[model samples]
Target chain A: MTHLLEAKFKITYPEFSLDVDLNLPAKGVTVVFGPSGSGKSTLLRCLSGLERAPSGFLKLDDQVWQDEGIFIPIHQRKIGSVFQESRLFPHLNIQGNLLYGYQRTPLVERNLHLDEVVQVLGLGSLLKRYPEKLSGGERQRVAIGRALLTSPNLLLMDEPLASLDMQRKAEIIPFIKKIKDEFETPIIYVTHSMNEVLQLVETMVILNSGKVVNWGPVEEVFSDVQLRDAVGDGQLGAVLETTVSEHDDKFGLTRLDFMGQVLSVPKQNIPMGKKLRVHIHSKDVSLATAAPVGATSVLNILKAKVGKIGAIDPNGYSVDIELDAGRPILATITRKSLSNLNLQIGQPIFAHIKAIKMVHEMDT
Target chain B: MDIPSIDSGPIWLSLQLAGVTVGLLLVFATPVAWWLAHTRSRFRVVVEAVVALPLVLPPTVLGFYLLILLGPNGWVGGPVQALTGSVLSFSFTGLVFASMLYSLPFVVQPLHSAFESVGKIPMETAQSLGASRLDAFFTVISPLARRGYLTAIVLGFAHTLGEFGVVLMVGGNIPGKTKVISIEIYDRVEVMEYAQAHILSAGLLLFSFFVLVMVYTVNRRLPVQVT
Candidate 1:
């Protein structure tokens, strides 16, 4: 049986209101992606039972957490949450903070063990240190470990990386990825950063103005034109699922196979057959009428067909185009180029890929 | 310079009264302080004003009201006299009760500020970690608010130790029953016993100074302010 997390919430304040009805897969990472003030955090709070909506219904795989008459308080609902701030107990040392939830959970119910979590989060050395003594990254790692040790049925992260500087974010993202890989808990991650969304999302929910604008598989949602508009200009991109096929050690490059086509990226340590998700920004992809013959610096050249063309920008400088390269790939090009090339829907064309970022690697 | 021989009875009585009052006030005022820190109820302002009334109101005014209320035929004292058959006024118990009222804000304010500084995030984080409300309070909120508890205890105890007017109004200088250190000093001075009065007054002044110094030292050494 396919377990599902079903939620329906209607919350209103004088200034803003959130009305979302979501039926999400109860596995992997489901990223709630939106801009700030899109009610992302509020939605996560509702799921965790931290914010109670007057009339709401929620159920996780047939276990009802909240309904018209049945309401489980936050503690009763088996969930773990990591906030933007570490929120570690200042008085308790790292070990105490890690064991707090683990200790409270009934012995029979506890599945995640202390030693395993300590090793996973690399918190062995910090056990005796108080929160005030740890660096920001270390503190956030402990916070994640503390939450995970509860063996929650669902994990919620509300912009865990938002407070961190770039270096600190780099330090913590690997641990978050490791947790996702090692644990069986389904995660609902809320983030406004498209970078985080691309790196972590298995399924995506796009929220805007207190409602779900769209929700689907990562690729489909990224391909949605509405997402392009919501994400604004520079962040528009397509997510492609690919597999490592060959390594050119001589050229310091690795080749990936996506939908029967090959693309090369900067050398990766991942072995052959390992699946990876790569993000290609629309601005990085350019169009050509015919395949270039001579040594062009662009490594990826796929023969494709233009699938759809977006409206000209208000500034009237550029337009967003979608191409069918076995998978939907997006490109932003100048309107002058579009008219210059006489581009038409379903017209055969060549898509030059300038850059591809390796977002996430699937477990082998 | 001669050291005057002092009667230690009033000192012991005062110490006992302060101890009992501080202990009882901690138990009773914790919930009040927590409520004041976190409650969004409209009555919060009213409750806050009531708790702080002792801070601004003259102790004799409070004592006169307490005297009327806890006197033999008064509202609280009448019921107590009938049930327990002991008068509340002019008793050690009456002194404790009055001191608790007199020193309430001293205890509640520090605790309230501490609870406020601890804030809702840690509590919510604890609850999300599967700790029950009561469990979170004990493990997270109480520990985080320890400094507040320290300041409250010292302030409450010291304030009760130095109280004069409330005890005089309700307990009426009954030796070994209601007469505390401050009242003993008053009696000594009234009887022209300058040396004994000087001893107790200087002792209280030094004690108050030390308590303030301790609170300030601890606060400075361990800064737990989150924002």
Candidate 2:
């Protein structure tokens, strides 16, 4: 159950060098997050043997893919990679592209079936189409199916959604969540979007200037203010991992059970008992001194205590608050509101969540 | 009403030369063009210049060099003559060899550009999918470069069909054995046999015009892909 992927490698360009020793978990989605030109994709390329690090050692569980003396070729590694551009062969039909890897992989080693992959990625209708004819999201879904059909030991995705518009990104996120839940294959995903990192990742690796700035569970790394500051724009928010406890079709609301509190939001189509990751923007959370009146429009009310208070910026009057609500939740409020509420570390307060949106969900 | 009869032997021989030259060049130049398109080695410039020499060098200059190379006492010819008791000069095989050299650039340049346009992304994607290097090339890269192949084949065949100086210098006029259509037309006109020359020349004119038209039409239909 504890599959480990170890990478001790160093690669140098004329102006940049990436030297890192990482022991990444080889089961769930491990997101490699960083700014542009920070060696995030390059690290995945090294793992996939696309760019060989001269002095490197990589081992996935017991399979040693590369070392000082032994180096496996890219085709032999059985690692699937989905690049930003899809990279689907323009000449091949969708079926042909999907089968390109399936046919090459030995039958004895195949763990996924063609029909299962086709159904999972919803590629049944588009099987006869060419890559040029498909939309960006459709192309990516096909690419994912193609990679999954290879039965890869590990899948590498480098900014797979970076090219799509918001709607297209929404279209592809569910498939990714399904893959993480339904498949046993490990995924090393590269992304810079904090929203994506929160929505998808279980293990988070923060890379800055070709070095690992932080690496741990997603919740632990996200709650680190220093790391949050490193990833700027202050888009920091709380990602609550919850299970759908009930769905009230009459009131059009879904009740999510998290840390013994049931939070209500708009009704979701997901089946009851399914796990979901919900993102609550810090700005949307307002602190309350006592439980709000019964008729307030604010839907979510949870008891939490202030944990850490961040410094106020020079121009802006806002400050970030870390709450100890079983699972840590982040809230940003103006200094004026903070003083009026007289918030302090370890002080009990009520968090009135104005809105809660389900960012991603997984089948149990 | 007296028109001299035009011999078709030279016409058939010219067709044979063009066909053989195009076929051999397709096999020979593909690897060279692929290397020229993909390699970043220092020797690429030198090799490129050598392949392109036929484009600028006078046809007679190249033919003279080939004539020496295939002559009875020359380096390549002497060894062949010793082994087989025959010389390559004035032979159909010699003409094929001369045409290959004369049209090297015609076959290689287009193929090289085509290979370059195919780029490395698709091939890299194929490799990621577990295709071997050779398998990926045949399946992904070749189809994408189909237009390049068409251009190369047409240009190589047409250039070989129209060759005069190289064929004259290397193969000479040996009647049915080595006299191609161009040399035959020249010989007819030299003896003031304008009627014979006119008949032969007209057929060649029609044939060349038709080939060019077909090339333009086909290229327009499938428009040459740069990427």
Candidate 3:
């Protein structure tokens, strides 16, 4: 349960320089979220042993991949990676691509079986199709399957869904979660989308301008007022992990427990006891000066307190409010709402959020 | 004018020679082109210089050096003869060797550029999936660089068909053995058979056009993204 993934490096090229100090988990997914050109992909390259860091150590599960005097070549490192583009071999059919990695990993200590992988990835029907023959999402699924069959101790995915449309992105997320659920293999997922970060990862490493801005649990990291530098102004929000309380067939609603508030949304297929994380955008939330009865506008009412107010944008100011029960929430209202409700730092308020505003679907 | 009249024997022999030369060149050129694509060697310029030497050097000059290397007195010939139990001098084997070297530039340039245009992510992704170096080359790099390989094959075959000074020096135009179409055409013209020479030359011209058309057609079919 305890393992350390540490790296410190300074890379100087003609056009760019990357200098970073990173400490991430040796288990679960540590999402590297940042803006473009922030060196997120470059950082993963150092971990994969594809890029040499003259003076650093990359050790995962007792094996030192690179150190002061020794550098394990990329071929020797037991790391698997997926790029923005699904780099499946065009010459090979889906089965061939999957087997390409399976054959490379030795029989001893193989964590996954070929059949299980095909089933989990839903790739059984695709085994005969060529890489070019599959759609964008199906190709990415094959790419993920190909990487997982290798039984890598560490997985690095650089914007795995960047090229896909929103619908296609929604398609591959559950497959990724299946890997996380089944294996203890640490995954380093690089992405810029806040929705992806909230839905996909529990731990986060926020990177900006070739530096580690913050690193912690996904919930705490996003709730941090300083995280504005990591996630852009428009994207700042709190990440909350909640369970499916019940599904109301009568109302076609799924009730989720968020900060002791039984928030209800349109019914989804997610069965009971399924854990899901969702990002409630700050702008979608409305705070009231006093609790009221017989209001049809808001689907959720949670007792909260003003945590901290961030910089003001053109129209309104965004406030970090902690749900009195648990979890932090973001609510943006005009400066008029702040004074009208006498909303100040540490003031008690009721946050009203609508369930239909969920940006993405959650899975069990 | 009293020499053996050029016939299908020489034409077939030349075709066989060019065919074998191109086939061998392709097999060897694949790895070389791949290396040129992926290797970060400081001496890549040096290797590139050597490969391009055949392009710049006069065919007779290259053929003369090759003759000396494969001839009895040269170092390569002795070891080669020792290994094969026969001399390579002035034979079909010698002609193939000369043609491969003579036509190498044609194959290398096209394949090299093809591999370059293929970019590196696909190959790296394959290797990261635990594929061994060679496996990645064939499974990932080759498929991605296919256009380059085709370019290499067509250019190599056509270039071998067009060899002049090199074949004259190394192959020596033996009618039933080493003589190819170009050498056959040369022999016909030397003997004042303009009609036969014109027919063979026209065939060569048509062959070049056919191969060039194949290259252009395949390139257009490739997924070339225009900016």
- On lDDT, the leading prediction is 1
State the lDDT of candidate 1 residue by residue for A191-228, as single tens digits.
88877776777888989888999998988888755565
* Residue lDDT tens for model 3, A14-54: 77667887766666778999888888988989988778867
| C-alpha DockQ of every model | 0.66, 0.49, 0.38
TM-score versus the correct structure, for each prediction: 0.94, 0.86, 0.79
Query: Judged by lDDT against the true structure, how good is candidate 3?
Result: 0.79
Candidate 1 clashing pairs, residues 3+ apart or interchain: none
Q: Candidate 2's residue-wise lDDT over A60-176, tens digit each? A: 999999997899998999899998988887777899989999999999999998899999899999999888889999999999999999999899999999999999998898889
Query: Which stretch of 10 consecutive residues in model 2 chain B shows the poorest summed lDDT?
Result: B218-227
Model 3, retained fraction of real contacts?
0.60
**Ten-residue stretch with the least lDDT total in model 2 chain A:** A224-233
Q: Model 2 in CAPRI terms: which quality?
A: acceptable
Give the runs in model 2 whose Cα sits over 4 Å from its true position: A1-3, A243-274, A282-323, A331-359, B73-75, B78-85, B223-227
lDDT digits (tens) for residues B1-227 of candidate 2: 96667788998999899999999999999999999989999999999999999999998899899999999987878898899988888898888888999999999999999889888888788888899889988998888888788889888988898899999999999988899999998999899999888888888888878887887788778744421
Which pairs clash (backbone N, Cα, C closer than 3 Å) in model 3? B14-B180
What ranking emerges by TM-score with the best candidate at the front? 1, 2, 3
Give me the displacement of residue B54 in model 3, in angstroms: 5.2
Model 2 is docked with a DockQ of: 0.49
